[model samples]
Target chain A: MKITFPHMGNLYIAIEALLSELKFDLIIPPPSSKRTLTLGTKYSPETICLPLKLGVGNFLEGIELGADTGLMVGGRGPCRLGYYAALQQEILYDLGKEIEFIVLDHPKEDFVRFKSQIIPLIKAGGVKALAKGLALAWEKLVAVEKLERTAHYVRPREARPKAATQVLNRALQKLRHTNTVGGIRKLCRQECDHLRDLIDRNAQEPLKVGVVGEIYTILEPFANLDLEERLGYLGVEVLRTVSLVQWLKNNLILSSLGLYSNRWLRINARGYLHASVGGHGLESVARTVALAGQGYDGIIHILPFTCMPEIVAQCILPNVSVDYQIPVLSLVVDEHTGETGFQTRLEAFVDLLSRRGQGGLQHDSACISWS
Target chain B: MTAPVYLGVDVGSVSTNLVLLDAHSLEVADKVYVRTQGQPIRTLQRAMAKIARKNQWQIVGVGTTGSARQLAGVILGADVVKNEITAHAVAALHVEKGVQTIIEIGGQDSKMIILRDGVVSDFAMNTVCAAGTGSFLDQQAARLGIPIQDFGRIALRSRHPVRIAGRCTVFAESDMIHKQQLGHSLADILAGLCDAMVRNYLTNVGKGKEIRPKIVFQGGVAANQGMRRAFEAALNAEVIVPRHFDVMGAIGAALLASETICREGATRFHGFEITESVYQNHSWECQDCSNQCEIVDIVKDGRIIASWGSRCGKTDSSSEYGMLGAGN
Candidate 1:
């Protein structure tokens, strides 16, 4: 059975590595674009989250390419994201495009069901395939984490415009062509080193801004309009938000081992937030608080326009801002948001940060000054 | 020696406003408010012509803000290209003393900017729906065969305004028609429309926002006394409207430009002669990738000055035109 999954930033990269090891024919849908969103919206419920609409579009595109089976990840929560899989299946079936919709949820709780679902792909490779496939995907995921971190560091200080972003993109593209773990690590290191060398050492230190938001919107360039890189271009260092690797570790690996909750989310977030509001609401608050504690100059909290979880977090964020006195800009984006307005807000936010970082406004000396 | 002045231009989807500020006094010397009519370059020309006719104002710095900022900035060689948020905030602070909240309702969009100690704290804008903005008011005014200018005065006469739902324009329009069929008084119906718009604005644009007192209202819709009253009645707070209420965005842009110019050495303003130049806009499909974006190129004097509408950032206007440097 050929496998297909919706793209969320670089998740497809690691997923492709695992599926390749399992020796399954796969249809990797084309990258998410305006066209993809148009098709997705055309078939989706009007008020559904952006990721759902885009996910449905990916499947439709995959179906057009002759792929029958769909793979999606789910969560148990107050957020609407938890119910997308079932809703998507219903939506697809109503459109007369019936196919196997395999949903993997709560990895530790449903390991048997998860293994059973993907058994067809594993059996296609060989007896020793499962272990090798997991390792391959894991190696790539780790390399990507390193790569994304290095890119965030190097982007603002790069001697040439887009140098860091270009190298990161090239490195990811190179990793896709290779098959081995060593190859992946070597390419990532090489690209990171090359980007490090291109950093303008003479250039002054950059303003540090922490990007905290919903996972998909924070990571996906299309959804957030390439926010991290845009900040980098404005000469601000972006502390990239959560990666899928971290998510996997927290939800799948740690929870599967019977851990009650993520330590950081439970401990660091306790004073600020009461409970896990689901869909990263508590996590967003926790991360923002942590970033503020770490002496970051600014925090940008982004989420889908209609995201209820983030809205709850957004209301409480002012208290965090009042206590810490570190500026936080909360941006709510939908498909209908205009680029000019989005870019303007970013520019204005950066200006605010820079102004705050200067003229004796910051008494703590903890804030990073814009050079 | 000619006295230096700052030029600010706010180019929106519906209108273009130009403000000239004296450098020392920080007072507006000349102002031009004109309908854009889907032709920003030409509309700008008319505004510039009017400003230029007054005197030879030595522009030390120029700033552009609004939806068409980049386009207008590229054409005029503005020193600072600011967003509507910053510009609006700066302008509100200039006129209103200790403004805690700012309500800006323009033609197509409505926005709420919250400020504390002269720094913008939070902001929210509603552009997706059209029930609460000025265009909706304009449409209802046209349908009622009443001049938009008289809408506010007539609405204030009603003792008891009927309640009308104003979530979306489609629903609001049908509801208004239904109210008309019920033989409701025209003034009452007008008052209801104002009430509904205020309700829609508070829910849609002002959601999750802390709307504190010392509220400053601006933008074209601020011209309506009915809206001002609606806001005051709803909030139980007096909304302060500035002297240059309709052109605050432009004034803010000018103020920001003046500040930037004093700090920076040189200005990038292309000068009044840009008013004479004819700019042509054209669009073509970029088939370089699967996402075929329709790129719009603005041509000036047989040369393509700028190109946009591509998500991938393939078309570089800086290298092609080299106009951004020529001004400096």
Candidate 2:
């Protein structure tokens, strides 16, 4: 069976490593573009968030490429993500496209159902191949995260515009092609060094801003309009509050073991939010508070327009901003977001942060007023 | 002898404003305001020509702001090009030394900038909707058969104003008609519209923002006394409207240009002769990638001066035309 899945930044890299080792025929959908969004939107409910629409787009493209079975993850939470697979299945069926979906839910939630689903995949590849695939995928995920972190650090300090981005892109391309774990490790180090070399050591210290928000918007560049790259170009060092590797470690490994995941996040979020509002809502508040204490210049909270958890978090962020004395800009984005307006807000926010960092107004107070 | 002055241009969606500030004293020497009328180039050129005929001063520095800042900057060879938020905040601070909040409602956007100790602390602009901006108010005034200029004065005559929904323009329009059918006076209906708009702005653009005393209201909409009064009534605080409210964005741009020129030691002002030059803007879809970015070119005489709007930054007027033996 030809299998396919949705894309989420570098998650596809690790997924590819795992699937290829399983010896399953896979059709990786084309990288997301305007066409993908168009197809996705045409079939999706207008009020649904951007990620699901993009997910639908990915599935359609994969189906066109002869993918009959779709792979997706299911969750039990207040977030709508838990129902995404079912809804997508309905959409595809309504369009007269017959496709099977293998949704991997948490084993802890329903061990019997989870085992029934996972056993076949494991049997297809054998236990030894499954172990090897898991190890390779883990290695690739770690390598990818490290490379991305290095890219973020070097982006703002780079001497030339878009230099760090180019190096990161090249390295990611190579990482995709290189299959061996050792090769991935070696390539990551070399590319990271290359990114560092592009930095201008003599440049002024760049402003630091933490990005905290919904997981899908935070990780996907297209969903957030390349927020990190744009901020990097504006000379602000972006500190991503979420990473796929860290998330997996926290949610999958830690939570499945009946241990507390993101203990620090839970502790920090105590005063602001007592219980999980689900889908990274508590994490968003906790990260903002932590980043503020870390002396970050500002915080940018981004979410899809109809995102419920992030919307709840957005409402509480102002109090956090006021109490912590750190400025927070909440950006709600959708398909209709204009690039010019987005760019203007980012530029203005960066200007505000830099000016605040300078400790006063950039202009002389002695200037004459027209009024 | 002519004195050196800095020029600022704000090319907004509805109007274009130009301000000339004295170089040394930094005082406003001249200003011009004109409707953009969907043609920023022609509007800016006409404004520049008017300023050129009125003043004999030398423009030493130039800056541009507003929605079309980049286009205006390229046309004027501006020394500084900045966004409307920074420009508005700067101008508001200059007007009120201890200004804490700036309520700026322009042609198609509304903004709330919060300042703490002369530094902008937080700000928010209207997103995805222009429900209660200047254009909406202008349309309402036109539909009511009232000249937009007298909308504020007419609103002031109301004793009891009816409530109108301000969530959406379509809803607000129908609500106004409903209020009118219920035998409400024109003045009261206008006042109610203003209040509803103020409520919408507060909930949307000014959401979660600290609206402290020393609130400075400036922008094209500030000219409407009804909006100013509505804001005052809602906040229960005195709203200060600056003398040159309509052109504050332009004034701020000029001030920024002056600052840049003082530090950088030179100006990029292309001089007033650009008023006589014929410029044409052209846009075409680049099929080099799936992105299919529409690249725009600003052609001055026969030479392309600037090109933008490509995602990859590869498509340029020079390279595309040079291959066809067209570029200089």
By TM-score, who's the top model here?
2
Off-target runs (Cα >4 Å) in candidate 2 are A362-371, B276-294, B302-304, B310-328
- Candidate 2 backbone collisions, by pair: none
Query: Which model scores highest in DockQ?
Result: 2
Deviating ranges (above 4 Å) for candidate 1: A359-371, B1-3, B166-175, B282-296, B308-314, B319-328
Q: For model 1, name the residue pairs that clash.
A: none
lDDT of 2 by residue, A61-126 (tens): 999999999999887889999989999999999999899999999878878878988987898899
Question: Candidate 1's fnat?
Answer: 0.15
In candidate 1, what are the lDDT values of residues B30-117, reduced to their tens digit? 7888999998888988988898777768888898888888788888888877788878888888777688899999998888988776
lDDT of 1: 0.81
lDDT of 2 by residue, B265-301 (tens): 7897788899999999999999865557678888998
Q: Compare the candidates by lDDT and give the number of the best one.
A: 2
DockQ (C-alpha based) per candidate is 0.26, 0.34
